[model samples]
Target: MTISPIAYDVQVHEYSIRVAGPDDLDSARAVMLDTVYRDFGTGYVPRWHGDIIDLHSAYVAPVRHALLVAVDERDEVVATGALDSRGPAHPPNPRWLAERYPSGETAQLRRIYVRSEHRRRGLARRMVAALLDFVAADGGYRCVYLHTDPAVPGAEDFWRSQGVAVCDEREESGQRVVHFEIPMPVTSSPVVVM
Candidate 1:
């Protein structure tokens, strides 16, 4: 499938988006760890000495995951998101999902982060739409699910704007988790150019 490159605002910095591979893992991990530290502040502990070595190792260990990165013209990683081919692990109690999802063929959208300086340029929304389009065109995923901390205020609304609906809510690991899901729309076959 040919996914067209999206146009950017003239005022925005020039950047490129691509599917990240092994070579980009170090930069990706640094972006992830730095964002985590910035968000968590002094409370950030050294998860593997707060280094990209171990973090990149763990991220690359997953088999069914896709990591995409957006880099500025200077080739510096600016934003990242990890898309998993499976939904959240089945809730310990199946009944917990009775009111919402009736199936498990969903993708997990995790670790979606954009640098503070790049937050309002529509980068996050573009990244998300690109990820969803990727999953939909791949033909197996039917939905995308994610959890966000509501204390951030705008997060819930941000996901909502992306067509994600809150399906459940709960607290875990000291954070208020708001579960959100977006049903994948049926996509037409891509035009084959041979």
Candidate 2:
């Protein structure tokens, strides 16, 4: 499933979207954790974000997984989006939702975050498009799945624009979760940075 890395550059302010490397570990982690803590509350790690402990192991090392980063002109990481081989847990999630996508066939989109200062300029969308392209090129995934909290401002709406919501329910923790499924071989071309 390994292929040459994908990279895209936008000319406006010289931001680039590309496959993350070892050098990006720290900045990528900061962008992810800052977004999560800002939106999902502080001290929510391990339970909700154990993967951040070692992003390279969770998203970069696996042949079927990927971590993409959006870096600004200064080469500072501003956003991150990753593809994970694991699917949602059954007992914690719905059996139907979990069964439809086995781990091997699913690409669970995770850590799609854009720094607050960098939002609304399509960085997130471009990163997601690149991630989708990576999955399509890998040829091992049948579908891309993701779950997001409605509490995060505009998160549900942004995902609604990208994929179809297969399940929207309230979890035992009383948190509303919306699960989305994106079709394979992305029908629309991802936005080129140019």
Candidate 3:
């Protein structure tokens, strides 16, 4: 199946949803780290030197996962989302699993970030739609779920606009988390590749 690039704003652009390869890992990690620091502010500093690199490595190394990046004309990774095929979900903790999803055929969306300068241009929404389209084409995913912290503000509304419904909420390790899911279509359709 092929996917034709959907036209967003003139300044907003998306790349073909490519399967993130080894060469793209560094760029993906860079985007993720930059986004974390920007979003969390100084609080992310302590963990910055220790865990960031390894976290990115895990996302890139997993063979069963699919990572998509959205870049502007300048070619920077403006946003990224990963779909974990094998699972109860990525990050697979029992607590996270029980509090959120009920354990089923699900694909997890993670590290969905867009640079602050690029917000409101609809790039994040496009990246998500592309990811969903990709999942629909691949077949067998019953749903796609993700978690976001309420502290981010507007995060919940954005997901809601994208058809994700909040299923659960909890506070763990001092972070407030909200789980959102969108049911996947049962039948696969051929995507219009760009």
Candidate 4:
């Protein structure tokens, strides 16, 4: 999938991180496919493009889940990140995560993908912030969980920098995946001074 020539020269500072509605399927899919094939090619759990990365269930969830996209100045989705109920749903479930919690409205930090050209510009961090804020606002979600491979360059390090504690690590389907958990802060009454 080729981006338009007009997409060039757009700065990250000009982008907006917003919630993805049903209308964003095309743009989101492009980002998801482009990022996975380029970044996780040959190493991201073989034969996953259709069943997981490009799955249709992304748009089927109830009120608690959200898919976020960072649109560049040209209104093209340059990156995407999603958070959904930690259960049988889009992109399949990481079973190990269920064993850790076994209950509660836990959120899986699924599908955080940024186009190669737009990386290293703090986009990923912003996407994460948006997802966290989204979940925090949609009450009942207790924490956030995610899994990534340390073997992938900077994958674990970047996630760790976000304050997600290493919860568990195990070999799954012959590949090593590290699981992380971040306890969502309870939203209390605001503090104000008059």
Candidate 5:
């Protein structure tokens, strides 16, 4: 099942949010890496970014996973969001929390990033809606889970506005991570622009 593209009018230009294909790998990777390096600074670690380096295997190729991108009128990718089939596990994530979302039944939101210049225009929310529509259409996901670093500007607030925060703790690296879960049976549908 395909979710219709969502269109947004930001200033005078238009943007479209839709599932990304193989052709989008470079731009989407660039957007994610740029955001990570720029926002994460010296805290960046390549080990944690293996997924971004191999976008196809991590997202596009997976039957249950999806990577959504928001592009401008020129078709330049400005933002990206993704859903992964894996649930958070121990070490980085507490086992108790991880158990709540089984591998096949959970949709984990990841790498939600919007270019600094293109934010505050509802791009993220629209992409999220598109992803949720994908999950709801798949009919396999029982819960939606995500973790965000509070260090990023507006990250905590954004997740708070979208889902319920069930865990808030500092990781071994002393970074504060907020875990959120969007209730199941997501009823959001894509708003197509004619």
Candidate 6:
């Protein structure tokens, strides 16, 4: 039997996702930490802690970036994701990417993490769909890309199932990194209801 995703304590059978508020930082942080420790063990803390501590500027407030959090039963953030503009202001790779994206915007999909307790319950799919819809609504994105570890068991399979194509896969530093991209569907004008 397929289990449905859980929401807040009041409605255990429902799950709600929304743009995060300042109050949700703690829960969001917990989910991120859980995901990192789950994947990298305890070794990434020192290397990534400083970056993690500064998530606010790029994800939280006073910035145009979009950060979404999914709330499960007990109102805990079971999943989280962010969209950082891959534009002139923040280019992930200026030398190569600038030539490729000369006229369109590319969004960098970041921090898509789902808690172990909520796995296989369709939360990941929903979260991705929501992020895509958000981008489509803004009418400013041509494609979205993300970097992930393909060797991590079901990671590649899951991303492939989401219609993501393997754009680049290479070894970086001491570890392997896989890059995937999905072209966004062009959004049409909204239907006007009389």
- Model 1 Cα lDDT, one tens digit per residue, 1-194: 43322221222357677767667777887777776577634334563224344544443454345567788878787888767654544543234543344434666676677888778877777777766765665566666777666656367789877665554355333435667876675674543433
Tell me the tens digit of each residue's lDDT in model 6 across 130-166: 6676566556667777666676667778878776554
Top candidate on TM-score is 2
Give the whole-model CA lDDT for all candidates, comma-separated.
Answer: 0.62, 0.81, 0.60, 0.65, 0.81, 0.64
- Residue pairs in steric clash, candidate 6? 7-14, 7-72, 7-73
How does each model score on TM-score? 0.72, 0.88, 0.69, 0.74, 0.86, 0.75
Candidate 2 lDDT over residue span 1-194, tens digit each: 22543544443256788788899989999888887788767544686798987998998888678888888889899889898888998878889888998898898999999999899989888878878877776667788999998888999999999999888886544758889997675443333443
**Residue-level error in angstroms, candidate 5, position 56:** 0.3
| Residue pair clashes in candidate 4 | none
Badly placed stretches (over 4 Å) of model 2 are 5-13, 171-174, 186-194
Better of 1 and 4 by TM-score: 4
What would the per-residue lDDT of candidate 4 be over residues 10-111, giving only the tens digit for each residue? 235989777665677787887776666677665345444453444346433545567778888888888888777754233344555566544347777878
Over 4 Å off, model 4: 1-12, 43-56, 59-61, 87-96, 165-174, 186-194
Query: Residues 28-127, candidate 3, lDDT per residue (tens digit)?
Result: 7787787766675544554322434654444455533466776666666666666665333334334556445544366677777777776787767767
Q: How far is each candidate from the true structure, as Cα RMSD in Å?
A: 5.4, 4.1, 5.5, 8.4, 4.4, 7.4
Q: Candidate 6: misplaced stretches above 4 Å?
A: 1-13, 42-51, 62-64, 87-104, 170-175, 188-194
TM-score for candidate 6, please give it. Answer: 0.75
Model 2 TM-score relative to the real fold: 0.88
lDDT of 4 at 136: 60
Residue-pair clashes per candidate? 0, 0, 7, 0, 0, 3
* Runs of candidate 5 exceeding 4 Å displacement: 1-13, 42-44, 171-174, 187-194
